[model samples]
Target: MSPSTLQAPEIAMRPALRFITCGSVDDGKSTLIGRLLYERQLILDDQLSALERDSRRHGTAGEGVDFSLLLDGLEAEREQGITIDVAYRYFATARRSFIVADTPGHEQYTRNMVTGASNADLAVLLVDARKGLLDQTRRHAIIAAMLGIRHMVLAVNKIDLVDFDRAVFERIVAAFNDFAATLGFRTITAIPLSARFGDNVAERSQRTPWYAGPPLIDLLEQIDVEDDRSGKPFRMPVQWVNRPDASFRGFCGTIVSGAVKAGDEIVVLPSGRVTTVKEVLAPGADGKAETGDSVTLTLTEETDVARGDMLAAPRARPQVADQFAAHIVWMSPEALLPGRSYLMKVNHNSVLATVTDLKHRVDIQTLARLAAKTLSLNEVGVCNLSVARPIAVDAYADNRDTGGFVLIDRYSNETVAAGMIDFALRRATNIHRHAYTVNKAFRTALMHHKPAVLWFTGLPGSGKSTIANLVESGLHARGAHTMLLDGDNVRHGLNNDLGFTEADRVENIRRVAEVAKLMTEAGLIVLCSFISPFAAERRLAREMVQTGEFIEIFVDTPLEMCIVRDPKGLYRRALAGEIANFTGIGQPYERPEVPELHLLTPDRDPAQLAQDVIDELIRMKIL
Candidate 1:
């Protein structure tokens, strides 16, 4: 059934509590959740019989049924006896319904933990009673807090291993409280329990006579973490344009905050087009929709609204800008470097974005801000970002649905980082583009030729620069205004600050692309001779210019031949470990999947190869 058609009255009166269990490896997070299900009699008779058989083969509990088997359903997870992904289960009691996420504890799966915690209202952090506290325990707590989970429950599992010592439990609680003082959690409840033995899980156990607090399940049933999104300003991210036929048009999405009804004034964000709702189509008889309701609404006037556009109350609008600052959790094994382009996905909108600067990295150990140039895997940092176009957003503290985003690697399509928006940069609002009468067309007319960039790429000693020099000479002799940007020559001036690292190479290509773009505006035939290895950056360069204005010419030369020719001795140095991250030697070179021109230089002369590039440009009508 559609969510809009569901019985909303029951959900509104008593919503299910969403929570996650996270901690270091072997802290019994999955076992804790499984025990809750078992003790509450939520497991079926057949599943219990299967569990008993599987426990004998894969269970770590030795003689008894491994409760963790209930959640660790993956074959790989069962074989490895570890949680590698988030596992979710649903259960209910007379007091409440609950959805619990069992998140992995390994450092490599931190991204999985972040995904599970993103929508959770509370985090049930389990810790081994004998171990006290560990790095990953602290890391998970910090990430949960950053993702806007305001309530925390410290589940000190395996109290039976330590003979249910009250002092050990109190010491762990005190240490966590000290670190959590600045995390902004509204409540912190610590409980001692043995998930394997069912002590203090569903019901209070007499094992710890000194303990007076309620059991873990009772505390979860009574804790209140609702934020009352229905009482806030109306906001809905348009997920689709519902149009069955030409006779009707409607915007469809679930309301994330506040309420909307017929005749209510709404604004489409980023475009700021104002319109009134003509009709609301929902399950409710009143024709009104509030938070968590998926409905369709027709506008009174036709506005330029599309998917990714937000419908919001006119009086309380979200910030719209191309630049912002955010806290990021770097998830990829490849480090995040400033100035490299990435794809940012916020809501349904995807835009090209770059981390302009790494403001600082947060030390999980000390919570100190340390200066950093890059963020390694699992590192948390604050960064300033710039996007290709403006997007609507809200501060994460105000609205998570509109404020959270993920950065994706353009080539791999892997999610590299998760971010929480803080605010738009002041400079983004101040900077403005000035209009001019003399533009690219006027300059093209004055120069008497069309502008284009011939990007020559290949191995270092691939004769790219030698042929580019010849091409520029021919164009200049023909009175076609031209410029040559050799890779080595550029590093002496425009890219002097850059090194040979992968990150530096990405930034190097980015600056050269921008310069080439400006030179194209002046109606000059720009020749860029660089061994741009990564295909993503080369693609970025092509996209920066107008269609048909960028031509990629691949200089095909064998690696053995280049090593033998070694004009600059770069290959020898790279092979001897004198240089690092050198393309074709220390690092990988992603060959162009397709190119406009391919020149075989082993048998052909430099003059003939340069002629090939010129002929291709002529065929493109640039000559």
Candidate 2:
């Protein structure tokens, strides 16, 4: 039914409840939601007719109107008889209105479920009575809790399959309750129902006369999960700076928490510039706006406020820092490795962030803390991150809107993980960069030459180190200060702790880049030779130095050629199953899209390729 038609005088003032239904595959989440809407007479007549027709073609029920067809609307979902994405439906009762999201139950779609649960205040977790508390059922519940859902409904669905036995219902509820106790849910209500037959959904079931709890609809209507954010600290992220004419300048955004009024003192965050709210403009508002209200407010003065900045109560400002600890839910197929840079979008700001450390990963089955170097798909980990700049944030426990963030792959632009900030690291505020007077300019003047890092990257046995060494020897002969950092030589000293794993390879390149940056500052020509398989790390190394200070030299040797000319015999061992994560043999190598110099090494000698590198550096004016 339309909410306007069913709106009662007393219920008109009630806030809408947003919830999600999720569990393992084929646990009847869609069917339960469809039955609830159908029982309330919310479906239109034409929709009901379509459901009847579609039921015959794709129905799991035997010659009955398949209620699941209402929510499983996708063509793929209908063909497979399962939910692949989240489906949202709006409906109303005489007592309340609701927005319910039916999230997919498949394990591969766990990321989809996280998206659905991020905004829900309550989670109605379904479980097949016959198969009590499966792995995915626990996974969804844990994810719901991690996303700040405190209220839950443990709907023991398909009870008819287990004959509605009281013992069966109690056992399932007991197991869930035992596991959920550690999840920190505020309220968990257990109910037994048969969603297919519409028993104990909108009304109590006659078959299960032993159960005494209220029906699903009644429980949802009565459950109090309201979060009065208007009473908390005021926080509004600036989405736009509106200036239609010279006479007006306004900041426009939705108030994420607390309330605001004209003349209220506010501070622009990460800058801490204080100003007074001159006026509040909101449609149908009375000079005030609270949480969830999108409004524009003019400042008393021309303060430096821009998009991605936040306005907050002056005395209760959010934390501003560049380093923090957080819980991340890895979403991409590629594993999350430490030291790899990603773009993190928190609220309205996008910043370059790197996972500094992966403290521990949560064991999905046992929820135990285990030391881990990286996080795979659908895994949860506690990690430390360092952002490119300081950002205003609150702890996730204090304010979810400002504290939660998503990591986007810098190269692919794919969302790789969702993270919730725990707290800022104390060292972030304590450590400060000390300025030095004798800078790179002074060193360059004394040395009579510009400093640059010539980076050599290629497959193993591709003559990267030999070419780098030759170039450094030529520079040294020309009375230029030079240092050659070969991959094997540095691994034996500076990067001895690292191995051939992807995570270790990333760190190895990161450390070498920092060293190269330092050498450039000292006005010394630096030659770095490494098998930097990942393009992202090459980009990272390039960004570390000043413009025109980093030159990428790609020794383009075919993999087969490298395998045949393996002077170190590493490729043979790798192909013989003795070496793991060996680039070009076991681990995949991501070639550079565009390098400053691509010296094909198959037909040319190493000395000629080294001369090609020297010629390119001279052409780029780095020599």
Evaluate all candidate structures by whole-model CA lDDT and list the values in order: 0.92, 0.91
The total number of steric clashes, by the backbone 3 Å criterion, in model 1 comes to 0
- Model 2 vs truth, CA RMSD: 2.0
Q: How many clashes would you count in candidate 2?
A: 1
Least well predicted 10-residue stretch by lDDT in candidate 1: 3-12
Best by TM-score: 2
Q: What's the TM-score of every candidate structure?
A: 0.96, 0.98
lDDT of 2 by residue, 225-319 (tens): 87867788999999999999999999999999999999899999889999999999999768899999999999999998988999999899999
lDDT of 2 at 516: 93
